[model samples]
Target: MKKLWNIGIAAATVCLLSLLNACSLKEKNVAVLSLDKSFTTRSGFEGLLNGCYNDLYFLYGKEDFVAPTELGTDLWANVGTAGAGFTLYDHRLVTTDGNLKVIWGSAYSTINLCNTVLYYGKEVKGYTSQAELNAKLAEAYFLRAFSNFILVEEFGGVVLRTTSSTVEGVDNAPKRSSEKDFYDLIISDLKFAVQHLPVNQGLRGRVSKKAAYGLLAKVYLQRTRLGEAQEYARLALETAEELINHQTQYGATLYTSDNTRSGFGKLWAGENNKTNTEFLFIQAVEHANGYNPEFWNRGRTRQFFLPDLGGRGGEWGAREGSPLYGRSNSRRFKPSRYLLTQCFEPSATTADTRFAESFTYKFYANANKEITNALATTYKKDPSVVGYVIKGTSAKATASVNFYTQTIEEQTNMANDAGLAVFTPNWTISTTDKAKMPMMVSDPSDLFDPATNKYKDPAAFPDEVNLTNVHPALKKFSAPLYAQSNQYWMGDFSIIRLGDIYLVAAEAALLYNGDKSKAAGFINTIRKRAALVSREAEQVIAPTVVDIDFILKERARELAGEHMRWMDLKRTGKLTKAYLMQTNPISGELFDASRHTVRPIPQSFLDAISNADEFGTNGY
Candidate 1:
């Protein structure tokens, strides 16, 4: 009977049916199929738990979550172009934004699923083993807590739906709980998760004891109770220390920078796959098996960070096989000047492998490509008409002429030149010339000068570049092979990693005792992996002052584009001072701290509630 339930028919079937019906079926199914029907077995509960996990794909995997978390932070600058949820960065979001509605609804929907799993799993009889049952329940608790945490953080005092909203009418009109109550539930749920989750789940994506500890540490740090925050931080540090001390026990180790590859470099290279030890928790996105809808199961985060390269396809898109190269549709957001220059500090462009590994500033000539005289006129007339680079071997190449600058006469002269090979009328290029020409280069200064061990012309690089088209393309989320029609990238997105745990512990220690040395030690561990020299030998090492600003900068260098900046700034109350006030040539804004800390509860949500007046908007 347990084996029968392991196939996930009980949960998957019900979930599919409910999805079709556009409403939850948990209560109805519970009544229709009792515990005796093998629907309440340990395996049955596991299926329901899987459903809760699946819901995350819908919640965090969307643009809404990414927009609120990434854009308008210290790291990213909105390019003032229309993309999914652009208003988030501009701080022009309203109560009726589509993405907000999805975020709000999807979070609660996932929470409901988690509640259902927890509610009925206790009543199940035939557990194959008590350990299995406990593990499944532990996962449910973690998912429930995580969903609620996202809710409370985003909306402040949101409705706390603990039990399954299976009884639809009963839950339909629930009131918002106090912020303290929300944190209490999150803490309790995480404590339960830590108690029952195994140290090793045999899969990197699954929740583990270490992951629970890491999340708990973050939760406590976020909560307003300073004493409790310090206490939990200590607990989190102990667990992190233990994990670091006994790496083999948990199959975890930091990526070390070698001559050829940096630890941060290895991560985007798909080296952080399912078995990679550094990952604590990941949203597992596999290539669709042709049966499931790819949209529901695949990850497209890579699309959001991409630069608008629609016209410059062959000339400037991702490299053939490099991890930093990928096809992207909407180049929604670009790296903020602050993040590019300050976070990695005096020499990010050269010293920090993380900076180099995370961004693509150059695109090589793909093939013997050219634009014709006729095409050049058209391209000149339309600024959007851009060329692309074909994947090819090219070395010692002169930088390609800026298409934006070329006159039609110059293009015609090149086209008529008998000595030149005309690949197309707008431009002429020999196969020989292709090997000697760069397709596109955004920032020529990004090239490192080994003699000085720093990027050339570091001071000359302008803080304000053309934000609309030219900027560093984020390579961290690149998924070349998994791209869908060269529009979106499909890759597994990591939610937590051991590197982050170290930072968490560092912050916790700093807050707990104000001991800079202790905090610096943890931060240095991350710095060492980045190939930074020891602090004693180098003046530009991890901050001696272990303050929030220092820690925030370090986080930016290490964790940018991982959807953490907004939360980090908000949690530390630095959103306005660090991000809003900082002027940039692109999409900088004057954020209203009082009203912008939390987003407005979607207008649709308020209108749907019975007591709509009581459920007032947040910080509107």
Candidate 2:
């Protein structure tokens, strides 16, 4: 089958406009491709709907929406100097920040596209039947609701624009709607979607009826979190169970562990990545077809998880550009020590495979492979680096360099391994013993202050702490093996998956009624999938107890880089300094719950609208 995202190119030929009638709206300040032109043909209408999802690539593939959702939260923190402004929540995170502007603009643009599609959908021709037309309309509904949900979550109660921002229904100086207004449209949209969306769209990145049910469950739960209504928890649980119980019918199920690869590992890496049955909603990109590099616009989101593994002289810089360690740009975000220490619990007897699957602990010697493809751009070779000739992709590493989270005993024995370079362990090691070792071993004491959960300042140490140099290489996104480049890489970004739905079910069950037993059943399913070989039973909970906090931690463990951390903390009323100090303490102290919970509305947006005074800077 032809890939879904080639809609724009394909539209030019198959869905040519019979008549061009573009309308301008003062509100959006962008011309809407008139529905009359779009609905002239079924292919044209399909192109219009797919255009609604095209904005998703701009939002998801870039740092705009990802930073708003992931940074300043507990699971992830800024590395080096790039995101300190937003991560620390200081003067840099103000309304004028480019990222803030991008978030607000991209969302509204997507919403406008959906509104246009829905407004003139009935006029669409060449549909085989009412069922086909309803399914198409249902997709637009999901996109509109999805975009609005992001708006409401990021910026509280926004101007509700149900009508297309075209000449047909122009409302130039619209005032902001209440949260109730947003949820009403959102609920209505999803209910319509659930009634009409097909069980299987048979295309990656498209939403299904199961996706509608899943998202509705979350929407209701969010309403409860916003203090809108408490009775909605029942609805949330019921909707979540509707999707959960009918997984087999919907052709979705959890990936189970095989002898060779764990389910969690298989879910992200290997042959089944883009086609994984678990993925419900995604921003999928087909290889080569998705090679448009509008100044670094490729899906380099995987680069966010890596350290700046730049070239150094010794084993520390052994593999500066290996596909195994994966390529990284200077702007990267590493996992918090709080996330590494508190959330993951891997024991020798009952190993947690999620810890291993999510992070990369070892660095292979870079073989300086030639980048033949022009699109696969990489950093230029550094003069001072010590990389070897190309070896088999997975050949043995001559040296070991890592930021490993290990037991003190494991560290002590591993410290004896030959050619161990730049060893930084989480557990404490003695200062005297460190000097005697052949390798440049780190004093685990210098890793972080156990009291504060903050990393030690580089200036405070005798040897400057290589904070950005040899940290763990995050591989959950599983950087592509063949064509390596930080400039552009085609990787699929998952927005919703079955693993998250399982967590939602557990959360709703506990929140709706204190059904700890019911919550345990849902959570244990995810834990079992993450458990190591022969230890699935050890990962099980006894159904003795569960709570909102436990659900948040499990989410952190399971879906860290999938981008929903800041919202998770805020939704559960745990965005307080107390919670941050205990968990993500670096910026936890810098956070001000008074204003930090809600991001400031972009200055560009405020300046653009006639009702600027009404939509102030969100108390910025």
Candidate 3:
């Protein structure tokens, strides 16, 4: 439940060493107290695995230094400002420094744990079924591959240590492995995982054959083994199709609507794995940890989402257009106009529904408590808006009711702008001003329902409850009623989902196999569901001519801030070009050629390695 950030490798090592001391039986058994048999047994192994999940989970949190780096940077065009904050990050540019090391250290720590388990899980006596052990090893392999995938994507080449950290002369320091070699290891591990992991796991949230296949396909795609990539991608897609097409309710058990948002983006939200059909692997979370997310690192949310929904004054600036709007206190990350333009039009006329209801807008009601759709009163909408808004412990907004009123003719007379303005404001008063308008009356209770529930009152239904339109206070993460109680908020972050596979397969079918119509068919299927209107009303689907370039852009529109956009560009060799087009409104800047593409390797690594000069640093 508690988030596990990166492992303190040095501290863990010291503790383990002390625990192994023979004299730790009685007198001064401090080491034994720290490192008990729990670290050595099957249950202990499971605990370590859980601990590994905790550490890895941090990679998916809000903190850029530790969370899913690719999701924020490499996966998508930059969401926030550049230099220290936004534009600088838009291009493939990032300087690997202090906190970036957390990713490296955490990754290595997990590798060591998995290696230790693979080495020792077999030695433990009195174990469960052999199937369980194999499954555990398979899981270990899958995790190691997953972790390595992260490292390879970020740091390029890394020292691949399969065993526990060694202190002996020969193992005191290890040289970095070549990227090819590193990826080879990943491939081997994934292949093993694919072979050993069961197609179905009895327990929910467990990795299955489909998960392995999906990962294997991903690995192949990254390696640029086109044939292998296509083969595995098809295999994964086929398996996924079976699960999706099946009438059985097995999937709903895995992913339920209670906690997750209703879109492809939910996969990266990191919580609520009830929909087993899509989520292959995720680092689950139950309790909140301030230090583990962007909220603690700075004011940013887990990732950017539509303009802030929670009444402003929390992290990520006052909810963009809400009554709580303001200049953010710690402007670490910021959404830009260029990025906003990238998200499909939020209006009903747009073909992309994700741009509409899928996101919460920043505009909130003015004195009349009515919402204005004007950009001035709206938050900066962007691709990053698709990212999760991890509500922090210090959030100040409290749950309250919004009210609306209308006569029968008034309800039908939707064109009465002034009448609508009474319930929904025509303009949003910026949060910069703390003054509250008297006309902005709050509904007394948190009960405004359309159904036959006790909260249902047609007179004060959605209209008065602030439900009729997108407002700045409508942030993705529900604000905690009490800031302190936020520590207990349960939200999982996602890394992948079923929708991506559909998109990927659709793209692959057209690009690699020359099956344009089939690709368009698959993509159209997804688009239709999202409320996206077809370019031609008579033909409601993406064309089958299969424009790879167009589909790439479409993917950005559909999947943007979920952390896949940047990578898509990178693989297509458009990282630099795509980002250069993004302009920062605050500074009137474009992506700098030198600083936009590559991140500098951490200085600490340079300091640790004697021949570090051999490894060139990224231009940034």
Candidate 4:
């Protein structure tokens, strides 16, 4: 089945083989002649549908897919480095940006593949049973809707091509469809998927009936129709409730605090087992073909969140026993100060396991390496240094500290004694005035003293704290295999999870029915898990009134680095006000809401099509 799926994906990449039969003989006999074939069997149709999944995996796994959604949002801030993501974060996006081009091309290309499957499935024979045919058709419908949803969210009112582009000149230049039309099509397709898709597909990556309902809930919520949104939200809630009730039957369950070692931390720590109840859909990545660079099977998510200076050779390098013992090639995005502090209640930072689990504040030196006094002076300027060694003699030596852990402090003191200059980026302890410093001591008694306590107001912390080399590292997607090699790590990317569904339920209840109590009930489920508190103790951590802002903040805290922020902000009409005006450090004031809500249609796309000039770009 895997071999057939691989062959199908390769064949689909060449041309829509099934659709080539409909093209003119002159055109079909040219380059597409060898590949011209139709999927006559149910297995063949299933294989073609698998090809669509492959394309989606490739599209979603790329850094570009993450950047457009995550970079410019309220939760994430750029690290003052120039890259493809800079334009997205700063709202300086031009139509020619390669990221924009890739997203557009990949999404439409996948859509075309889906169209081929759906169009040709009507004539296909050799179905062993009717259930098999319906399943294949349902998968195709789901992929088509998913691809169209991606297009609509990023580039608004995009050309909605429902049929295959087999006849080159006829269907090549499609005009932009209405946003209403696009939504209607998505809703229609998803409804069919929900009706036909089974309860379980027996695979983690494959879409199930629950996934379809979940998507419909999202789709309805995103559209302008409030009544429909409420209806679908109700449907989604019922669907989620069904899944939650029968966990074993569907092979799904929530990652509860009591059973899991890390509680909320277990979700992202690469512990995606077969019985993982949280994951609704995951992009199953394999280390097949020995890390093929061209294939998107290897995950690069960990690289985006990692600080560039903390990889292998840097001062605060990744070491063997630490949580951050992984390869991090780039620090493209960092958590905004608002997210690290303001998003969570001050008490939640301590009580909530997510705060500690999500980020790494301490770094260790894995090897014995020297740092010159000049480089130390440039990176960290401290006058106390007098002929420092600046080398780690042992792996246990704490190289750097973002938080004020006692082990780190003792290590720093040792470095100072040994003339090994210690570098602290955003914090410092004054030996003379102990009253001012925010210290994190191991002893609980030290927390009571104002002199040795955590920083009260992280928002008031200096802007320099957000720099690439010194910011708090996101440790959720850390890949240990990439520690020594340049090749990116192979890890599964989760599309939707039970935690996300809980939040979606909360949002839907709040927005659609204005049922704050029910929304709170849903929100409490996740909050309780986050705080490691029981259902009865949830009131302490859960919000009393479920508002849009609170839900958005909760989403940020729960779903950061998962690539869902921009849509959350945009869907709730909070993008311009919350993200563009208030949150973004670089382009906060410059973001024009009307112009920047959706991306501009790529210039190359407009130039290729003759009717595109008449259709115009996405408000470019």
> On residues 1-620, what C-alpha lDDT tens digit does candidate 2 reach at each position?
13345564332221111101112242232223443575558887888777677667777767676678888878777876667766888777888877777777667766777777786686878988988899999998998899889888888887777766542544435588887889989999999999999998766678898789888988888888766344787888888888889888886777898666678887876356667788778776665344332423555566666655554313332434443444455446777776766786533233567877887654432332322222111222232222322221233322221112111111222332432333444334465554443333433354565665767665665464444344554566654431234344455667888898888888877777788898999999899888755778878876675788788989988988777888788779888888887778767777897788888988776665566787688878
TM-score of 2: 0.84
In model 2, what is the error at residue 176, expressed in angstroms? 0.6
Model 4 accuracy (lDDT, Cα): 0.59
Q: Please list the residue runs of candidate 4 whose C-alpha ends up more than 4 Å from where it truly belongs after superposition.
A: 1-5, 14-37, 81-91, 167-170, 202-204, 224-249, 273-275, 288-297, 310-313, 316-329, 345-349, 369-468, 479-487, 533-543, 577-579
Q: Which candidate's lDDT is highest?
A: 2
C-alpha local distance difference test of each model: 0.58, 0.66, 0.44, 0.59
Give the per-residue lDDT digits (tens) of candidate 1, residues 33-115: 45334547656656666666655666544566777777656666554444323334344567887767777766776676677
RMSD to the true structure for each prediction, in A, is: 9.4, 7.9, 12.4, 7.3
Instruction: Check candidate 4 and list the clashing pairs.
Output: 253-277, 388-419
CA shift at 245, candidate 3, in angstroms?
6.2
Residue 111 lDDT (model 4): 73
Return whichever of 1 and 3 wins on TM-score: 1
- Select the stronger candidate by lDDT from 2 and 3: 2
lDDT of 4 at 201: 75
